[model samples]
Target: MGELFQEAILVSILAATVRIMTPLLFAAIGELVTQRAGIWNMGVEGTMLMGAFVAYIVVTAADSLVGAVLAALLAGALMGLLVAFMTVTLRVDHFVTGLGLNLLASGLTLFWFRSYIAGRPQPTFDGFENVALPGLSDIPYLGEILFTQRGLTYFAVLAVPLVWYFLYRTKYGLEVRCLGENPKALDVKGVNVAARQYCAVVFGSVMTGLGGGFLMLGFSDRFLAEVTAGRGWLAIVAIIAGNWMPKGVLLAVLVFAFLEALATHVQVIGVAVPHQVFLALPYLASILLMMGFKVRAGQPAALGVPYRRA
Candidate 1:
């Protein structure tokens, strides 16, 4: 272990962990917002997949990164639109609706991918250029990885504060949280419970889409079916594990990211550990985090139930 720590490979592994954590953080905070509004959105995976595909498609076509990202956001919001429609307008169960959306996203993206790319060697765009923060870019060791990540990385970092303030410091945020606890009570108070919930779902979904797009635009630059893999689910778990707080969620994502980093690092360092065992590190860490911690924290009172007018 001491010899492994001395290797330069550890630095690369740690940097990769930070890169992985950024999108997870984005998705976690987004889920936190939606859940706080009393809605459990399982469609994050779908939203992200859609966003990633759209972003890659656009980038590959127009060769414009900004356009691809914006389109990805809109595509994500559109997915959220579906979730909002079913859960809020049609008054379906949030969990059922969310699950349905996930299936739809998976199937739909696969359909499109098969049609467009013939399904093998999936389409890819060039990865984003790393943008270094002035002065900070020159710092030794930690500088390049932290300061020179892609544009989306910086945006995801900024989203932490923006989301934190929106949830804690805004009137709409309070109403959203209130609706989660008691939509009936919020309705009685003229809060337009459905409207607020719809906004929350859509907003959360847009972030999900952006997070997905970040996967392609920033890192992978490729559109493989279900390329998001299980990161979206991890995001949901991150929310639960973080107890729905921004800082807590960030920390949780870091833990998940670190495990992934460690697994890859062990392999690279040729640790006698089996490669498959190393691969299990991230998932094992998540299972441990989920199983070990009995995160008893304040949750929105009426979360997951659809509100109907009496």
Candidate 2:
């Protein structure tokens, strides 16, 4: 235990934890908004994969990080538009729509990757670099842990409070929340429920895309099939575990990220356990946490139910 707390190892783990949490934070916040609007978007994994694929392709071709990221955002929003059309406008089953999108994304990304890089060496590119805060970064352990990170990491952390305020303090947010609870009430009051839902789903998907883009641009040097690696699903879990609140979701993300960081370090620290066990730690923790904390009470009343005009 003492060895585990050594300054170097501890700092490494903490920094890794923050980096790991960034993507989840983005996706979870987006999903939180979508769910709050009464749309159960199960296609987040697919959306993220598509984003990663788009970002990678754009970055490789255009050699511009900004362009790649923008492409990724557009891809995510387009996917969200499809989801909204199917679920909101056409009244398709939300889960089925989401599952179908996931399949579509998986197949499409693989197809694109094969076609683009066929009979050639896999391409690689430099990702985002860590930026240390001025005076704050010079502080001791806390400074290294919090003040030194990729720009996206800082954005994700700051988004938590911003999202909380938006959800609890703004009119648009109140309308969004009402969409999940009593959409009919909003309709009665002349609010466009479907329009609001469309915005929420699109907004959530854009963030999810950004999360995927960050995964590729900030963490990995090259693109691979299914590069999202189930982070999208974990984001959904974080939302559920957090009880649909931004702060709660952030806490859940941190716990999961910590487990992941610990898993990586355990191998380095010469732990005698099977490597696979450490690899499974984060996932196992997720299952246990979900089992222990049931969030039915906090879930939106009309969640997963499509709104119909009376």
Estimate, for each residue in 119-154, the C-alpha lDDT of model 2 and write its tens digit. 999888888989999999999987889989998899
Poorest 10 consecutive residues by lDDT, candidate 1: 1-10
lDDT of 2 at 167: 91
How close to the true structure is residue 101 of candidate 1, measured as C-alpha lDDT? 92
Among the numbered candidates, top lDDT falls to 2
Clashes (backbone N, CA, C under 3 Å), per candidate, total 0, 0
Q: Name the runs in model 1 displaced over 4 angstroms.
A: 1-3, 119-123
Cα lDDT of model 1 by residue, 1-310, tens digit: 5656774766677778888877787778887888999888988888989988888888987889899889878987899889989988898888899889999989998988788776466556787888888999788877866886777788888888898898889988788778777788778887778788878888888888888888888887667778987889889888878877888888888888888777777777787768888677667778877886685566677878888887
Please name the candidate that would achieve the greatest TM-score relative to the true structure.
2
- Candidate 1 clashing pairs, residues 3+ apart or interchain: none
Give the 10-residue window scoring lowest on summed lDDT in candidate 2.
289-298
